[model samples]
Target chain A: MDAAVTAAFDLRSWSAAHLDRVESALSRWVVAEAPAGLGDAMRYAVLDGGKRLRPLLVLAGAEAVGGNVQAALRAACAVELIHAYSLVHDDMPCMDNDVLRRGKPTVHVQFGQARALLAGDALQALAFELLAPDDEGIPAGVQARLVRLLARAAGHEGMAGGQAIDLASVGLALTEDQLRHMHRLKTGALLQGSVLMGAACGSADAQAQDALRRYGAAVGLAFQVVDDILDVIADSATLGKTAGKDAQQDKPTYVSLLGLDRSRAYAGELLAQALDALAASGLRDTRALDALARMVVDRDN
Target chain B: MDAAVTAAFDLRSWSAAHLDRVESALSRWVVAEAPAGLGDAMRYAVLDGGKRLRPLLVLAGAEAVGGNVQAALRAACAVELIHAYSLVHDDMPCMDNDVLRRGKPTVHVQFGQARALLAGDALQALAFELLAPDDEGIPAGVQARLVRLLARAAGHEGMAGGQAIDLASVGLALTEDQLRHMHRLKTGALLQGSVLMGAACGSADAQAQDALRRYGAAVGLAFQVVDDILDVIADSATLGKTAGKDAQQDKPTYVSLLGLDRSRAYAGELLAQALDALAASGLRDTRALDALARMVVDRDN
Candidate 1:
């Protein structure tokens, strides 16, 4: 096969292969220290569902930087665990009060609300546990960096902070900038963090790191824009959860602020920005990232 | 002063001084990243209240181990954050449904269930964030170990695991062993983790670490036993919250299972065990740890 032919990335196969690794690791690690039936709740929340996008972003970032494979794997799972926990808590009666997620009952619905809350809390701790592996597969420096990156993204300044803003923003008119800021913290930080954690797993030049940051930012925003679009146009079945939840809840979103067509167009623009930043990275290969970026924009759900 | 005379450690002075340091650090770090009023809820939950036992345990353990001061400070704050978050969640309507904590309205009562949930989640992340400081005040190895100890103690098979069992055993008649197991995970794990994290901050040989572990376990279980005893004998004013609430809920407790006198004796016995472990550690100075163990057994609240 020609170099150009080999260079062409097939995201389906890539995703399939990586998802298997993530699924297996999640299964093994999620139960490593769970007591009694709590492991069952955690496994239910983590395994056999979701797109596993964050883990893929982590792996792709690691590949771009030729990062440590063990650290990359752990970071990948850690991010997904964070994402899963957020979703679990968000679906609780006290939060979003949702019943469906990833075409199944939300954690709170499957397990009781209290169990769900405990599961979410345990999952958050389990994430850092994964990063700080006892066997020392990765260096301690990388472990600290991974924990720092993850904690920042998941904590008050990042996802939780964004959710706070979002929760308070309900029924209120939020400007494009404000909405962007909210999403930047809520979703963007972790997405960017996944990339940075991957980079931290190994060596990445300052310039390359900057490029990856921009790529992650663009891809992250593109994801939200696409999500907003899907919430408006895609059916509940296709979206895997109730469609139009934001509109139903009167939450401000890209579609709510910019209309569906503009949101779709904006997602494309962001996708272009992501690819441009990836190109600036000057890595040996970033086709996986590019394909992911495009997929984020073009996916119907 | 003679060495023997100085060896008579005063816990009151030690706690007062360390509490000032812990409180100030917590105030600075808790708000460092909070968005909107989420920080307000977090600060409210963390500051100006509670016994601050966990932080004291960490500091004392560090002092005994001659550990890195900076890392010890961070670990102290991190473990407390986990403890605070757990309380916030535990007091929510979906869990224990308590309306009071430390004589104030529960977090969910004051901030609403949704914000309370987010605040607790943020605090947990903040715990990890504190451990993984960007300035590198602590070595990466120490940081990893600190995170591992805290995460293991806070996650399943630890605090959350114990809570799950406690939640499930609401009306059940649990044996003494079963009740001990529950409290060990629910409350003992983080308490024990405080000591281990402190030890991890610098240097402790296997023998010393083992001794510290034993001391932590004894103090941890002693704390719960004292708590149960207090719930039976102390008033809401003295206990800083409702008393006799355990019997009200019919949940298994040391007092409920073992009777008040035996439970009190058990706490005293555990305190003795903790002191014995310190003696076995063979460290030059373990007076602070000794003081803390005594405090855990004897504190009115």
Candidate 2:
């Protein structure tokens, strides 16, 4: 579609409708009455939190592939759960030691460290459980596919693997290639996996799937690149998290390696790459994915 | 199905063969080359540790139900991964503050708290990944079923939920019913889940499934009762963990509530109940499950 058509697509309205579905589904699905108030902590970590970017990607990707509605919704919620759980654990004193997240006290700060630990663990399990449902509303093949995609994204070879590199790389200077590798595993895998999962909900042929993969990769890396830029430029108030903390922690980043100007330029390049991939996808509609790509690169947060 | 026939079934030989399969599958499947040494910590936590009782239970349960071989093996490892991950997290300073486990330093003590946390998180994801493989060796329906079963066992409603209660109930004088509820969630869910998951790998009739469920419940509870008894009576060296830990932490247990003689008798009763359930299952062969139940109640450590 042309820029005029894309601009007229009303991304906000689309997001609003989808986010409503996602929020309601999450509220219903996440356990709130678990034994010993564990559910309370789980609900606290997940509900009313973050920007829901992952869910948007899932929904958008599913839309691109004409994916199954039920599967898409579950995939959306499951990806978000994984994201939320990572934040909970990362904020622990043992990990990032951060006190604040999304403008609220971190889970460990609010509900003691032990409950926070279990809450994160439970959330991770819930992600997989949600992906692989008992009923046939989502096909068995689709269910297993979603589960594999999600687990690979969230598991050791993906997000956790990246986080390990992050933890071990403190005070070390990493080359651009090394930084990209880490970011690709850490943040990029889940973002790409979200799209793949959404596509898995439906049937996307090889060509279309490959194009979406490219789109997802470009968009995912752009997110981290933009994040690095924002850390340098945005304040904690605007970011809804502690900004410039990467520098404080001596962690390597795109901005640190390439300078602010180069990092900004790199994010722009990635956005263009994402848009090109979406154009080449051969799908009739990719407005949501297009808008999300722009939003990732342009958002103040 | 007579006791004489059961006695002649050779549980040790059966377990030895299955345990070998489980070990090899685990070694090959659990990520050993994850970025930044994360894999090292994960392997350490999972390998050369514990009795692998959960895997044994899963294999036995599957055998009893004539489960699909591939799915059964995956379920066995998946349940054990959940068990191992739980142990890793539970041993952290914020939770049990355990220094040693499986006769060695805990994950946190050996790998540091941060890597321990990530390793546990990754392992949980891997469990679901293993359950929901991409190929068709295990049917998609079975994959989805196993994921649901394992997640419910490991998530907020099961192990994590039980742990939350345990954390809250520390130093409190819990009644027998209250203790049972806590232990059921903490340990029983996964144990029962292993059986249920094993059953899920095959086409067990509803009647047979119900019988297996009963057997699982009885055996699961008996395992914990025996654990409590061992905590009081067995030495740390014998138990491969710190004996008397529950008492030292002021955590309530069967020994603390019902005392030794009563706990022993209760365990015996549960074992009988388990045996009865196996007979009621009407499966052609339940010798493996029968032997496992006996092992759970009769083992010293």
Candidate 3:
């Protein structure tokens, strides 16, 4: 396709095909084997739900770099598993205590807390397991790089660390900078890691890597901004989660800090920044990445 | 040292030296960097406690194969971190609900459930992070191998799976095979993974690998059998945690399956099996492995 045609490419169809592939891969990977309840809870947590945005970012990142399809698929699934596991753990009574997610009962609510906890723990390990399979198709160097990136993003320095901050910040007012720092570790790190993991599947020049990193950061933050806005404006039915949870919990959010109108504008600005980074990447096939940035900024949920 | 001297080596001194190295490495790795409370909980969960048997197993296995010291140290700390994380989670109110561990207040009891949960999650990620560092000292192949081994041992097919089975089997009668299967996955897997991870740090022939696997499996099961015996015989203070928890929870155990005398006899048999595997390994410097087997079988706590 030419530039104009690629620019006008049907993202819905593209995403649909990718989502189907991811769903099938996830179903195959998340099995209900010997330990009956744990496997079932894991499958319940992972399969048949959500946007699969992290996986999409992974695939887009890989596509941008002309990366291997098989490796990219594995990376995509791995990131989604991490994201899913995080959600399972976060929804527990000790944390968010939410009863709903993805328009359905949360894992902790559907399967009791103990099973939910084990399911999350198992999913996290499964993510790394998928990334570093005993297959010769994936190079050892690639496996090591993927594991290192994912681990850091999911560990104390990243998502989990950010979560600790979120927990401590409950019912407390926070400055914009502190909120941004918290969001960067909490949600931004894994999203950035997804993009880098996709890049790791293929080779990228330093210039391209820098651009993708910037693009990932902007998109990651933009997603969160949009999320906070939706939490305020959209109902629980539309958002597929408990609406206005941040305000209810007295937790700080971008919408709370910048106001809804400004947060929406900020998301748009981040979208522009993400697109600019893509342009600077100097790669020819970043249509999916560009479309994804638009989707993140535009989505209601 | 000469063969006779090596055969008659003082195991206590040798273990003490290795324990010192493992403890120092763990202290260096388990840092309380960011997210304030999360790091504290992680440090609290990992530091200043436990027998460090898993780390010792890793060191001994590495030593048996002349593995790289740095790689072995990393593996040792990584395995212990995984173990510590499991303990933190297991002690949570949702699971075992114990108030004390290592003779101190459990993580959730001291830091609250949220911090404890995040700490456990972070520790798990930290374990993988330690295994696959962004360094050239450890080869990519070795990192991939170590990660794959550890993940499988800790995931659905291993420790987590065993825990699920344990949870479901509470208040239910289990056959000998069923009980063994549970222990194999729960405790045996990580123990065996430690041995395999150590072997991964060095070069081992196929025959040697088989022997080590047998040795690991035997020792792993032996450790659990002894644990069951100790749970019945030892008091709460002596065990450093709640004693008689298995029976209290109505959980099936080796002691319940094969009375005390038979359980003790089974542990002795397992120790002999482990030693025989070590002998079959044809590795000259297995003094440490032999002594460890004895310790596992003989230890009251």
lDDT of each: 0.90, 0.91, 0.90
TM-score of each: 0.98, 0.98, 0.98
Q: Tell me the DockQ of each model, to 2 decimals.
A: 0.84, 0.90, 0.85
- Top candidate on lDDT is 2
Relative to the real complex, the DockQ score for model 1 comes to: 0.84
- Angstrom error of the Cα, residue B150, model 1: value is 0.5
Which parts of model 1 are misplaced by more than 4 Å?
A1-6, B1-6
Compare candidates 1 and 2 on DockQ and give the better one: 2
The DockQ-based CAPRI class assigned to model 1 is: high
TM-score of 1: 0.98
Q: What TM-score, to 2 decimals, does candidate 2 have?
A: 0.98
Candidate 1 lDDT tens digits, B1-301:
2376356678898899999999999999999457768999999999999888899889988987789999999999999999999999999988889988889999999989999999999999999999988795678899999999999999997999999888889999999889889988999999999989888876899889999999989998999999888898899988777788899999888887888889989999999999999888877688888878888887888
Model 3: per-residue Cα lDDT over A83-106, one tens digit each: 999999999999889999999999
lDDT, candidate 3, B114-205, per-residue tens? 99999999999999999888864888888899999999999999999998888889999999999999999999999989988988899889
Of the true interface contacts, each candidate retains a share of 0.88, 0.97, 0.86
**Looking at candidate 3, what is the lDDT of residue B145?**
90
Instruction: Give every collision pair in model 2.
Output: none
- Ordered by lDDT, highest first, the candidates read 2, 3, 1
Chain A TM-score from candidate 2: 0.97
